[model samples]
Structure formats: C-alpha cells, structure tokens
Target chain A: MKTTELESYLAERRQLVQEALARNLPPPDTYPPVVHQAMHYSLFAGGKRLRPILVLAAGEAVGSQPEPLLPAACAVEFIHTYSLIHDDLPAMDNDDYRRGRPTCHKVYGEAIALLAGDALLTLAFEVLSRIPATIPPERILRATRELAASAGSQGLIGGQVVDMEAEGQPVTLEKVNYIHNHKTGSLIRACLRLGGILGGAGEEQLALLTRYGEALGLAFQITDDILDITGDFSQTGKQGGVDAARGKATYPACLGVEASRQKAGELCAEAGALARALGPAAEPLELLAGFVLRRQG
Target chain B: MKTTELESYLAERRQLVQEALARNLPPPDTYPPVVHQAMHYSLFAGGKRLRPILVLAAGEAVGSQPEPLLPAACAVEFIHTYSLIHDDLPAMDNDDYRRGRPTCHKVYGEAIALLAGDALLTLAFEVLSRIPATIPPERILRATRELAASAGSQGLIGGQVVDMEAEGQPVTLEKVNYIHNHKTGSLIRACLRLGGILGGAGEEQLALLTRYGEALGLAFQITDDILDITGDFSQTGKQGGVDAARGKATYPACLGVEASRQKAGELCAEAGALARALGPAAEPLELLAGFVLRRQG
Candidate 1:
C-alpha cells in the first residue's frame, strides 16, 4: 500500500472508531445525571483509540463491516481507559498527568476513578452483548471469548501482575518480555483474534494474524518506550521518562535506546511480513503495522 | 412449598453454580501457577455462591437450563468478587481478612489484587461468550445486554461511585439506599435479569423478576448491615463492623437495628411475593429471597 493509501486507511479506522464510540452508548438522558457525565468524561477524553481500530481493521481483514464489531470495539476502549485510571491510582503509579488531562482517578478522586474503571469494564461487556442481532450468535460468542481472554489473568491481568512486580527491581529480559507480552501482547492478539473471528478468518488467515499480532504487539510496546524517552511531553500526553524514574520494566530500560530501536524495527518488519502472508486481504493490517512503528505518538 | 423442599431446591441450585464455574475456566494446569491459583482461590472460596445460584434460580423461573446460563452466572460472580477485592484494598475499604482467609490483594499484593479484580471482570464476558453454539445469537446478545446494563455506570458502577463519595459522611436515608442499591443490588438484579433473559421470561415475567430483584437486593443490604453489627466474627469470616467504624452508610445506621430488621423482613416478603406470582417455578426464587434474609453469613 502507498503512504497515501495507508493514511486514508488509518483515517477511515479513526473515523469509524470515533463515530462508533460517539453514539455507542445509550443516550445520556437515561442514566443518573452524575454517573452519565462521568462515563462520558473518561471515554471521550481523546486518545488514539487503537483497540477499537484494531477491532475494525481486523473485521475488515475478513470481509466484515465495522457495524458488527462496534460494541466490542467500544468495549476495548473501555478496558484501556479503566487500566489507565487504576494505573494512575495514588497507591499505584501515582503520576497525575495522562492523555493531556489529569488522570481519571486524579480528576475524579481515587474512589470515583476506581469505580469509573469498574464501570468502564462493565460497559465494555454491555457493548459486546448489544451487537446487531443479525450477527451470528456463535460469532458474537467468539468475539466476547477473545475479548474476555484478552482481559483476563492469562492476558492483560497476568501481564500487569508481572509489570508491577518488576517495578523497582532489576528486570531480566525474560521478565520484561513476559510483562510486555502479557500486558500488551495479549490484547493485541485479542484484537486480531476478534477481527479474525468477526471477519471469518480461516485457520490460515488466523495463523497469519496471530503472527502479525505478536510482531505488532512487541513493536507497539518498543515504540511506546522509545516515545517515552524521545517524544515531546505535549505529544505523548502521559508524563515522559517516568518509566525509568519509577523503575518500570520498559523495553528501553532493559535493551538500551539504540538496541530498543533496532528491536522495534525488526518487530515491525516481522509484523508487516505476517500481514503480507495474508495476501491482499491484510494490506490494511500490514500498513497498520508500519504506522504503529513510525507514528509520532 | 415446605422448608425441606426449599432446602432441596437451594441445594440443587448451589450444585448448578459449582458446575457452571467449573466448565468455563482454564484448566488450572494450563494457567501460570500463581495467576491460576489466585483466580481459583477467589472463585472457590466457600460462600453460598449466591449470585450464581440466584442466576440459576432466575433461569429456572422461566424454564432455562442451569448449563446454558453458567457463563453469565460465573460472570456475575466475577463482578461480585472484583468488588470484594477492591473493597478490601488498602486504599478503599482496607480489610486484611475475608472469608476467614487473607484477602486477595493482601496475599497477592495490591498490584496483583487490582489485576485479579480486572481479570475477574474480564472473565465474566469470557464466560458469557463460552455458551454453546446451539443457543440462539439473540439469546446470547440479550443475556450479555442484561449483564452489561446491570454492571455499568447506570447500575453497579454508579452505586459504587456514590458509595465511595458517601463514606465518612452524615448520609441520609435516600443516599444510603442509593449506595446499597447500586453497590450490591445492581449486580444482584443483573443476576436475575440475565437469568430471566436466558430462561425466556416474557415482558411480564421480566418485570416481576425486576421487582423480585429490587426487594431481594435491598433486603440483602439490610441483612449485610445487620450481620456487621450482629454476627459473630468467626461466623462471618470477613472482618465485620468496618462499615460502621468507617461511618460508611448502612440501613441500620439510617433506620436503627429494629427498623432495619423489620425492613429486611418486609423486603424479603416482597421478594417472596413476586416469586409467588410465578406459580411453581417461582418457589426457588422465593426461597432464595428468604435465604438472603435468614442466613447468618
């Protein structure tokens, strides 16, 4: 895909996510005023919406539309938001800034922030369940299963456990890989799995997507670490170099900046190759892999 | 129905919950040792497994099988367990004990505790999606919809948000009700609603279940408050009276013990009446409501 084609594809996903989340929830009028406002607050706060985009892109990869996957997509964003809030808790990471705004727990108070995370997660399931009835029940079940696995101990939770455990400790490459692979990699896998499941990706297609997911997941984390060190504060939204300060087990922390950069390049190429393995169907997914590595954010 | 019949019925539902949770999770062997154990520890801790039982009973009220609703029932339990872990966190309710054992975050550390909560919440969806392919897509979607609504900002999350805000305050009756209603009640309500949806409850049956849920929920809270003051520490297992000490709102605090007891009696009766409307199928639900009130733990 040309650079121009990739940009448009990315833009299409961005629009799809924004539009879906914008109206994805029921009308605010139905809820208690305060709770409704709080829900909108964290969800609407601007971010890349990477998870939802993954859902859409994955769905499109298998010749699916954005509509069937919207609820699950919105749900992915909810889980991501919930994690940010909990991570920001006074007892946890403790930094105040996030996504160019005060963190959810910071702005909402720790208790509210905690509840917000809980609410966001619940909202995610709610969204998944509300998918269009025309979609196969089996498909909906598959998507929810992928998402649930992504969210659970074997996936994100397992990853987070290792991540926090590694803080202030010397993180071995094994530990670092476990943290990134589980914490971030699992969900990336879920995104592709969701796309594949929703899109009807066959065994071969799924196998390719799985490889793409592995490569992209690592590349995504490596890029995040690089950005933490090199990106401007205004652009990254989250506080900078704080990972090193907190002694977080970031990729750059273990590999050093130059090595991390090389690793990220290698991972991106591997991801692109995996996407290419899907032939033309995965062009957008392949282009996405490059964008994940090269994007300024 | 006679009390013996009720006991038999309750026993059957309890058995159902055990099976439901059993089939849905990863084989403990497959899990990362610690992660797997923690998930099982919280999951199997010996309570009545009341939420799943309620779900099963609710399904029975409309002829739904116990097996089909297992995923959702387990999901409800997951949400419930997540709340308990967070409630026990140092930054929140801060109890060192639960069910006569060290609390999750206590044994696992706060970080793992948080992830455990996240993992449990995520698993709820996984369980929901794991339902067999034979079940209609519409039924699965509807079941999930009920799950999400009860779990989200409009429900449990909202109640928790308010509960956090209201702690250590001079709370009014209305405020206390809101906190209690949402914190525990929303989920309890969802348990039945999901069951109803799964069981094919008609609009009328659903409405009746809603009423049953509301009464049972309030009664459940009132009983929790009463237990905090009245139950023995050895019996309850969890550290009791923390609510009163924290000046957290409670029915007894608002209504005094006698009135609270009377109110629980009234609510349980109301729940029973709603179940009675279901004829024979409602008997288990009625007994379930009574079980909520009369049990010491």
Candidate 2:
C-alpha cells in the first residue's frame, strides 16, 4: 500500500473504531452523566488510535469486516487509556497534564480519576460482552479470554511491576524485554489475535498473525523509546525527555539509540515477513508494520 | 439462634472465609518480590471481612457449605478493596492510613497503589475462573456476570460517581439512597446472590436470599451512618465526627436520628423475615441479619 492509501485506510479504521467505541460505551443516562463524561475524557483524548487500528488492519488481513471485532478493539484501547490515566497520577508520574489537557486524576480529582480508571477497566469487559450478533458466542468468549489473559497479572500487570521495581536501577536487556512484552506487547498481541479469531482465521493463520503482532508490538515500543530521546515532545504529547529524569528504564536506556534503532528495524522485518506470508489479504497490515518502524513519534 | 451460637457461627465462618481468602490469593513472587509484597500488604490488611462472611452465611442458609462460594466472595471484596485504594489517592480521599496501616497509595506510592488496585481487580476474575474442581460452566459464567456487573457502572461505580458529585452539597434522601445502593449496596446484594447462585440454590430460594440481602445491605449502611454519629472512634476504626467534618451526607443527616433508627428496625425486620422463610437451615443467616442492623459500624 502506498502512503496515501495507508493514510486513508488508517483514517477510515480510526473513524470506525471511534464510532464503535462510542456505541459500545454504556449509555450516558445508564450511568450518571458525570461518570460518562469522565470515561469519555480519557477515551476520546485523541492519541494516534494506533491500537484499535491494529485490530482492524489485522482483521482485514484475515478476511473479516472489522465490525464484529470492533468491541474487542475498543476494549483494548480502553485498557490502554486506563493504564495511561493511572500512570499519570500524582502518586505515579505526577504529571499535571496529558494530551495538552489535565490528566484524569489531575482534572477529576485523584478519587474520581481512580474510580474513572476502575470504571473504564471494567467497562472494557462490559463492552466486549456486547459483541454484535454476527460474531459467534464462542468467538466472543475466545476474544474476551485473550483480552483477559493478555491484560491480567501474568501479562501486563506483571510487566508493570517489573518496570516499577527497575526504575532508577540499571536494567538488563532481558528485563527490558520482559517489561515491554507484558506491559504493552501482550495487549497489542491480543488486539490482533482477537481480530483474527473473530474473523474466522484458522489456527495456522492465527499463529502467523500472532507472530506478526508480537513483532509489530516490539517495534512500536522500540520506536517509543527512540522517540523519547529524539522525537519532538510537542508532537509526542508526553514530555519526552523525562525518562532519564525519572530514571525510568527504557529500551534506549538499556541499549543506546543505535542498538534500539537496529532492534526496531529487525522487529519490523520479522512482522512484515509474517504479514506477507498471508499473501494478498495482508497488504494493509504490511503497510501498518512499516509505519510502526518509521513513525516519527 | 442465641448470641453464643451466632457468635460461634460468625467466628467459624470468618475463619473459614479468611483461610479461603489467604489460599486463593496468588502466591507472592510470581513476579518480582516487591509486587507480591505490595499486593499482600492490603490484601491481608485486617477488616471485619463482613462481605465474604455474608457470602458464607447466605450460602449456608440455602443448605450449601459456602466453601464453593469463596472465590466469588473474595472477588467482591477485591473489587471493594480496589475501590478503597483508588478512593484514598491524593486526588481522591487522600487518606494516609487504612485499617491502621498506610493506604496502598500511601505505602506503595500512587503509581504502585494504582497498579496494585488494578492487579487486585484483575486477580478477582482470575481467581473466579479457576473453580476448585468440576462445576457447571454456566454457574461460573453466572457468577462472573454477577461480579463484573456489581463492580462496574451499573453498581459501585455509579454510586461512586454520584457521591463524588455530591460531596459537599446536602444530597437529598432519594439521591443518598441511590448512591449507597449502587456504591455499596449493589456489591452486598451481589455477594448474597452470588452465594445463592454458586451454591446452586433454586430460583425461589435465590429470590428470598436477594430480598434478605437487599434489606440487610440498606440496614448495613444505615448502621454505618448511625455509627458515624454515636460509635467510639477507636472501636469503629474511623475518626468519629469526620462525616460531619467533611459534610458528607448520611441517612441520619437527612432523616434525623430517631427516624434513622426506626428505618434500621424496619429494614432489619424485612431481612429477618426473608431468612425465617428458609426455616431451620437459615438459623445463622437469620441471626446475622438482625446483627447487621444493630452494629455500630
């Protein structure tokens, strides 16, 4: 896919994901109006929407409409948004602002923000349970399980604990890999796997997509670490130069910029190869993998 | 049941529930030692363990051991604990201590406390998913549905949002009931309903238990409101007069002390009648219901 084609695909998928997210969310009056507002705050805070897009791209790679998978996709982003909100709490990163506005805990008060994060986390599962009629109940269960396992203790939470313990300390490559794989990578892999599973991809195709997603996830994180050093903070939204200030252990901290850059290229190549193995159906995913490697942020 | 027998039963159930909770919690060191330590700090923090004990009593009332119901009991409490941790954040309630120890956010820092809460919430489902032995998958799914629903928007989260919005204002009696019912009442009801469902009690049996639970839960909050006015701070583990200090709304605040006391008796009678309908099997539960109404905290 060419650059313009890729842009159009991403834009279309982003819109679909957003609409699905809005639709899947608990109706405003179903909850008090304030709860809905707080939930929509971080959710629609407007980042790259890369996570949900990955779900669509991977689903398309396996001959799915992406609509059936929309619940899981939105759910993955909800988890992502929650982690971001909690991560920015004064007790956590102590950041006053995020995405150019006040962070959830900052604006809502620590209590409501905490409740908001809890609300969103549970809401993710609630959203997943609302998968459309076309999707099989078995497939919904499969997708939900993938999400739960990926985001739970053995995955993301475990990784986060490791990262916190390693802060301000020297981190090994093994430790960095462990943290990234769980903290960010597991959920990303879940996004693709959910798409593939719900899209009716066979086991072999699922395995291939899993490989593609894992590699793509690593490449994405490597790019993030690299961006933390060299990317424009104005564009990144997060104050980029703080990794060293907080003594956070990042890929760039563990391996210099040159090595981190090499690792990303290597991961991109691996992901690209897996996506290409799916033949014609995988072009959009191929473009996405490439985008992960080359993105400025 | 007399006071001696009731105390013995409550004590026995508390021990059983505590043992089950300790056993079900993920053994520490599955990740870095610190993560496990952080999680254990609050998980093991002492409280009345009322919720789980209630699950046992409700379960046993329907001729079930309540042992099979412990996971659901623990899950509800995990949700409760997660709410407390988040509620105590600097942006939230900002309390430094909980149950005489530093709050999770206070002891572990905001980031870890946030993650700890997240981890606990996630583990609740993980614990539920693993039944001790063969059980109907439908029951498991039903239990999960009860727990997930109770913990999120339709239940605790809804109450929390309203409470946050109404912190200083003189919230109306209707709104206060709405808040308490969702914030705390929903989970309490869930505990009994969960116990009934998990114990494989019949639908008729479950309905009675549900009524019993709803009445007891309302009375539980009313008792809490009463305690805030009259109980000794040392005995209650809260600073007496803090509720008025914060201008937080309570039943007594709106209904006046005499009416509040009468309401408690009314709720208690309703709960006991439900338990009495179960006859001899519900002896402990009948006693427990009346006891809940009289408690100062």
Candidate 3:
C-alpha cells in the first residue's frame, strides 16, 4: 500500500478502536468519579492505539471481522494504558508528562493514579472474559490466559524490574535486548496472538503470527529508541534525549544511532516477509511493519 | 461441629492452602528475583488464610473436592495479598508493618512493592484462566469475570477510593457501609461465588451462597473493626487504633463497640442460618460464621 493509503487505513482503525474503548470504559461520572476520571484521562490521551490496531489487523488477516475482535482489542489497550500509567508514576519512571499532557499521577495524585492503574488492569481481564458468547469459551479462555501471562511478573513487570535496575549501570547489549524484548515486546506480541486466537487461526497460522509479532515488537522498540534521539519534542510528545539524560539503556545508546536504525530496518523487513506468508488478508500487517519503521511519534 | 473439631478442620484446610500457594507461586529465585521475593514475603507472612479457606468451605458446601478448586482458592489469596501491598505504599496508607512484620513496600522499597502488587494481580487472572480443563470453560469464564468486577473500580478499588476521601470527613453510616461492602465484602463474596460456580452450583444454590457471603463478609469486617480497637499488636499483628488515628470510618467508630459487636453477632447468625440451609455438607461453613464472630484477631 502507498503512504497515503496506509495513513488512511491507520486513521480508520484508530477511530474504530477509540469508539470501542469509549464504549467499554465506565463513564467519567462513575461513582467515586476521581478514580474513574483518572482512568479515562490516561486511556483517552490520544495514544496511537497501536496494540489494539495490531489485534484488529491480525484478526482480519485470519478472516475475522472487526466487530467480533473489538473486545479483545480494547482489552489489550486497557492493559497497555494501565502499564503506561504505572510506569510514569513517581515511584517508577517519575515522569510528569506523557503524550503531551500531565501524567495520571500528576493530575490525580499518586494514590488515585495507582488505584486507577489497578482498576484498568482488572477491567482488562473483565473485558476479555466478557467476550461475546458467540465465541467458543475455550478460545476465550486461551486468549485470556495468553494476555495474562504476557502481562504477569515473568513478562511486562519483570522487564520493568530489570529496566529500573539497569539504569545508570553499564549494561551490555544482551541485557539491553532482554529489557527491550520484555518491557515492550511481550505485550505487542500478545496483541497479535490474541487477535489470531480470537479470530480462529489454526496452529500453523498462529505460529506464523507469533514470529511476525516478535520481529515487529523488537523493531518497534528500536524505532522508539531512535526516535528518542532524533525526533523533536512536538512530534514525540516528550522531551527528546530524556533516555540519555537518565542513562537509560537503549539501542541508540548502546549500538549507536546508525547501527540502531539498520537493526530496526532489518527487523521490519523480516516482519513484513512473515506477514506476506499469511497471504492477501495480511496486507495491513505488512503495511504496519513499514509504518513502525517510519513513525515519528 | 465441636470447637475442637472445627479448629482441627481449619488447621488442616489452612495447611492445604499453604501447600497449594507454595506450589503455585514462582520460586523466590526466579529471574528478577526481587519482585518474586517481595511476593513471597507478603504471601507467606503468618496471617490467617481467611479468603482461601472460605473458598474451600464454600466448595465443600457444594460437594466439590479440594483439588479442582485449589487454583481458584489461590487466585483470591493472591489478589488479597496484592491489595495489602499496594495499600501500604507511601502514597497510600504508608503502614510500615503488617502481620507482625514489615509491609512489602517497607521491605522491598516503593518501586518493587508496587510492581510486585501489579504482578500478583496479573497472576491471579492467569491462574484463573489455567483452572483445570475438567471444569467447564464457561464456568471458569464466569468466575473470572466476577472476580474482576469485584476487584475493579466499582468494587475493591472503588471502596478504597471512597475510604481515602472520607478520612477526617465525618462520614455517615451509609458511606461506611459502602466502603466495607466494596473493599472487603466484594472479594469475600467472590470467593464463595467462585467456589459455588466451580463446584457446579445451580443458580438457586449460587444465590444462597452469595447471600451467605454477603452476611459473612460484613460480619467479618465488623469484627475486624472491633479487633483493631481491642486486640493487642502481638495478636492482631499490627498497631491497634491506627484506623481511628487516621480518622478512618469503621463500624465501632460509627456505632460504638457495643453496637458494633451486636451488629457482627446478628450478621454472623444470619450467615450461619444461610449456610445451614445448604444442607449437611455446609457444616464447616456454618461453623465458620461463629469463627468470624468470635476470633481474637
């Protein structure tokens, strides 16, 4: 697909995800409105909705319609948004801003922010279990298990633990890769797998999607690292070079900017090839790989 | 059942749950061991395993064996432990001690404790999804959704939010009841409902178990308030009168000790009657109502 075509495709998918998320979330006026408002603030903070989009695209690739897949998509986004909220807390990354606005904790205070994250995470599983009765219970169970495992201690939280420890330390290439793969890669990969499972992909198709997800996840993080160095504050939604300021381990920090860009390019190409193996319906996935490679924010 | 027989039964069930928890948790030596170790520290602390025992007794009430229900039992305990960890954070209650020892945050520092809580919560859903294939997927899914709802913004977290806001505000009895029902009662209710669902309860039986749970839960919290005012640190495992010191609302604070005791007794009696209605198999649950009412800590 051409650049304009991919842009339109992304815009359409993003809008679909936004509507589903708004519908799935409790309203801002939910009782004890502070926590609900905090949850809404972070969730609707104009994120790219990349993970949910991946869910929809992967489901589409496996012959499932978007409507059937929207709940799973929203579930993944909730998990992603919750992780971001916690990651930006005073006790965690200590960020004051995210996505061009004050972070959740900054607006709602630390305690409410923390509870809001917990609420969103709990809601994610609730959403998954509430997937329509039209889908097989076994499939929904499998999808729920996959999402939980990916978000659990051995996955996302584990990565955050290591990443926190590695800061200001002379981390090796292997350590940086582990951090990147776990911190960001696991959820991204889970998004693809969730889509495939809910979309009724066979074992072979699922395996192909998993491999594609792994490549795409790695490439996406590398691009993020490069963007932190090269992109402007307006485009990136946060101060550039903040990673370097904090002595955070990143591809560009460890391998140099030129080498990091090359690595991301190779991974995206591999991801695109894997998407091609899934045939014509995977065209969006193929384009998404390119989009990740070229995204400024 | 005689008190001695009930004591022995409780001891045996507690041991069974302890063993199950040990088997289900990742070893303390898991990679990024700090978070896992933090999880272990809070989980193995010498508190009564009230929630999981409720699960076992409730399952037994419906004539289900312990083996199949172990995972669900452990899941509830994990969620309970996680909430305690987060609740003790500096930004929350900031308690330095719990269960006669340091809180998770006090031992592991704020960041690790926070992540540890998140990890445990995620693990709960993962464990639920992995409930034995012998149980129907639909039942497991229903249980999963129920647990999440009870723990979400409208449930446990919601209660915490309101409780925090009500501190020093001269809250009414209705508001205090809302806090108790959501923060403590929701999960307690979930435990019984989960047991009933996993044990193949009919709708009518499930309804009875739920009402039994509601009464048991409220009685349990009222007793907790009484204990906090009258029990010693050595017995209750934390400082007494901390709630009043924080200007926190509780049954005793709202209605005075004599009235609080009367309230607890009435609720327990109601709960006991409901348990007895479940037939002879619910004898342990019948006994447990008395256990909650009369416990020293």
Using lDDT as the measure, the top candidate is 3
Clash pairs, model 3 backbone: none
Query: What is the C-alpha local distance difference test score of each model?
Result: 0.80, 0.80, 0.93
Q: Count the backbone clashes (under 3 Å) in each candidate.
A: 1, 4, 0
Candidate 3, residue A162: CA error in Å?
0.3
User: DockQ of candidates 1 onward, in order?
Assistant: 0.66, 0.40, 0.94
lDDT of 3 at A151: 89
lDDT for position B118 in model 2? 89
Q: How accurate locally is residue A272 in candidate 1, as Cα lDDT from 0 to 100?
A: 84
TM-score of each: 0.92, 0.90, 0.99
What is the Cα-based lDDT of residue A261 in candidate 1? 89
Off-target runs (Cα >4 Å) in candidate 3 are none
Q: Given candidate 1, what's the lDDT at residue B148?
A: 76
Residues forming the 10-long window of minimal summed lDDT in candidate 3 chain B: B1-10
Share of native interface contacts recovered by each model: 0.82, 0.39, 0.92
Model 2 chain B: lowest-lDDT 10 consecutive positions: B129-138
**lDDT (tens digit, per residue) of candidate 1 on B1-297:** 777888987787778778777776666564455666666777778877888888888988888777777777888887788778877788677789888998887787776677677777778877777776656768878888887777777778777667877888897999988888887888888888888887788999999998899899889988989999989888899677788888888888888999999999999999999999987877888887778888888
- Which one is best on TM-score? 3
